[model samples]
Target: MADMSLGPGLGSSDTCRSAARQAGAPRVLLVIPCFNEEASIGGLLNEIAAIGRGYHTLVVDDGSSDATCTVASCRSPVARLAQNLGIGGAVQTGIKYAARQDFDFCIQIDGDGQHDPRAIEKLLDAYRSHPTNITIGSRFIDHSGFCSTPMRRAGIRLIVLALNGLFTGGRITDPTSGMRLLDRSAIAFFARSYPADFPEPISLAWAMRAGLTVSEVPVEMRARKAGVSSIDGIKSASYMIRVLGYILLARLVRAP
Candidate 1:
């Protein structure tokens, strides 16, 4: 209702990363959106550390009524929001912080434990190969790991069809995938303006419309170990329609 905002065995990462980034690698920041993810978060933090030494992590607790806030406080600097602003708001907050931190690139990972921290290599590798600003970790490209449920898969396919058929000049295999990496320019763009609802696909179309380089890399993901999906069967159809309307309608009326 109000406006927004990790681990012990982890000492402050600054002491560890200050040396790592001295090798000339761009500073990387991980933005994790959490809502009642207490069951899966603690273990995920451990995995994140294993990704690399220089990577910094920030957990935005979206007004959860559970122990999510307390659990993440020990590991990372948590932005506990005053009220629930949804996942989009949480990510915007993180990106804004990333911009202030002077991060060279930022990656958005899910707290539900659905995204694999290890696949970050492929995302980074893709970034290195192009002048791209956004690299999304796509599940369908390799058809690896869990690709979500049948109903949601159908919805995602429909959205992709629409993107290729009408909007988003170039094709993006998994617009709805939350596992994405953003370079400096993208961090600036997102820090200034981001979609308020269902940001994945809408933001992808918006970025493409704005003429930013966007690419996708194949990745493996796992089924959620805890917490429920934001979209359920009852709302999937309507959710799909709302997102489509937002993307198509918003673009049509923008004053060039």
Candidate 2:
């Protein structure tokens, strides 16, 4: 079994020293964006640990009012935000920490156990082969995994249409996929200033517009094992509008 017993007080300081830093492997940090996902995170951590890929893990606990921090800290390094910084902020916190630690690559994963840790190798492999600044693990590239609902699928299609129109670089199939691989450039950029509330689609579109190489790899993602989605029901419509506006503005912005 993976050692799931990290000590308490990891979040006692501004910086936490909780990773093992195993040698002879690429310096990759798995940045998990967590809210009140106390129930699902432990299994995800264990799955990642079982991969034996020698990845350092950091759980960005976004001011959860539950046992999220406690449970996650026991398995990996925990960055406890004073308040909920939303998905973008929480993800950026982990990326910033990884950048400061000099990790060569950073991979973002959901804390709700939606993404399978086994496919992490596929993402890393695609990065190695293509060498893009960012590699999004796409569900629609192969039309596999949770394809989502009709309305949501149509929304994603519109967003992707905007992305392709905005950037000369090809197209992105799954614009809202949270599972992504970020190289040093992408990591450093996100560490400085990431998107706000709804980040995935906006960031991906913006990165392509900014002349950063972006690509996609095929990966299967599951439904969240626990907790409610932050973007569901009424929130999704608002998310669509916000991300669309961001993409339009990004396209008009200067490249580089």
Candidate 3:
């Protein structure tokens, strides 16, 4: 089982109430999945604390062989996985925790610091105004942020074409965006089963197939603050091909 523990000054009834008053928002949990991100985790936690939005933060350490858990524990609660389960497993762990804890919403944020914490408000607002099962933070809609390399952009375009063609849901511009918001229903569905590989694109396809509504809000993303990306260099090409394959396969299978 994954070990769950709260960080100092977090996950308390008093804390939750205080945050609710500050934001006047429902129970929201920020699920951060990290692997060997010790260099950047501390900064990310500090940034969230600075926001002071009352959204509870959970760092799902995906069996990092570093001090990531140690650093994250100093700020927010952590559900440390016993072993590396890739991004999919790590996110599913967080989703399950959110379901059991009865959170109103769960937001997935990467630990490498590419996703901006300030844009979180944009996501929350989108959900509040036009609620959907999933709200994706996209850098392509406005095209104002660091939109990544040309090759990766091309790859994302291909994946988007495939998703729009295969799925009946609305058009998805950035299927590879890591930042997303999930309602209770989406959380429950993903908690039960989330893709373990090429999760971003594949899970989006699965969620759509499962009859969940998805929408996107424009958010600016910066380059990674620290640590090398898992999908870099030649790996980008391989990632694109594999993710495309998974998206097609997901279309063929029954929705989870």
Candidate 4:
């Protein structure tokens, strides 16, 4: 049997101790942006809680017109949004909350199951050690166990390659991977001006423009357990175009 007693402050004893172990390591917030993701949210939250690290999860329920809010609310400390804010806004909401609450770092994760909770430790390890540069979970680094459609994989590779050339002047390997860890500097940066739509790509460029160091760490990706992707096929093409245009626009603006 699982520990039904687990919720927010109750199980965070382990996380608090773990946080103490690192001495200077930032307090971590695992931010999940959800839209009608009740099926996977509960399991995902429990899995992350099982990590035994002092990690708190915030589910920015983006106006999920389903059991998502109800189910999430039953759990402890899961935040919710009153209106559909889309992915970008949902994530930004969580980020802002994390910043305001004075968390040391925030890990942006998809509410869908495409991101593996187990890989979180690897990203955290990198972030803890580096203490600089944003750590992104890249699914294309080794490609040993990740599963995705061929077309989507190809599209991601192309986008990653282009992103490397255009922004980082280096290869990203997984440009669209939603799993990422941001330090306090990054957390503050984005809390002020996160992209409103399709933020993963645009935010990368924005981080770079702010002279924040960025790096990718290898992580195996998973297929979503339920719910259709917000972006696919033709949507990917449109997203690429829109982000590319936004990148150019962003470059024109002087850094704050």
What are the lDDT figures for the candidates, one per model?
0.82, 0.81, 0.88, 0.75
| TM-score-better candidate, 1 vs 3 | 3
Q: TM-score of every model?
A: 0.90, 0.89, 0.92, 0.86
Model 3 regions lying over 4 Å from their true place: 1-24
- Summing lDDT over every window of 10 consecutive residues in candidate 1, give the lowest-scoring window: 4-13
lDDT of 1 at 104: 83
TM-score of 2: 0.89
List ranges where model 2 is wrong by over 4 Å: 1-24, 254-256
Q: Which residue pairs collide in model 4, if any?
A: 15-53, 15-54
Considering every candidate listed, which one attains the maximal lDDT? 3
Candidate 2, poorest ten consecutive residues by summed lDDT = 1-10
| Tens-digit lDDT string for candidate 2 (1-256) | 1112223433323233333234335678899988899999999999999988767788888888999988887788888888877888888887877788777889999999989999888999998787899888899978877776676787888898888877865568888999999999998888877877568987886677767888888888887788887667767777787788888877777423
Model 3 C-alpha lDDT per residue in residues 127-213, reported as the tens digit of each score:
989999999999999999799999899999999999999997667898999999999899999988998888899998999998898
Q: Write the per-residue lDDT of candidate 4 for residues 1-256, one digit (tens) a residue.
A: 1111122442346566566657875577888888999998888877777777757788777877888766766663666666776788888877887777777789988888778888888988887676555788987778766647787776666666556666653356766778999888888999898887668877887888777888888888777888888678888677777766776776777533
Better of 1 and 2 by lDDT: 1
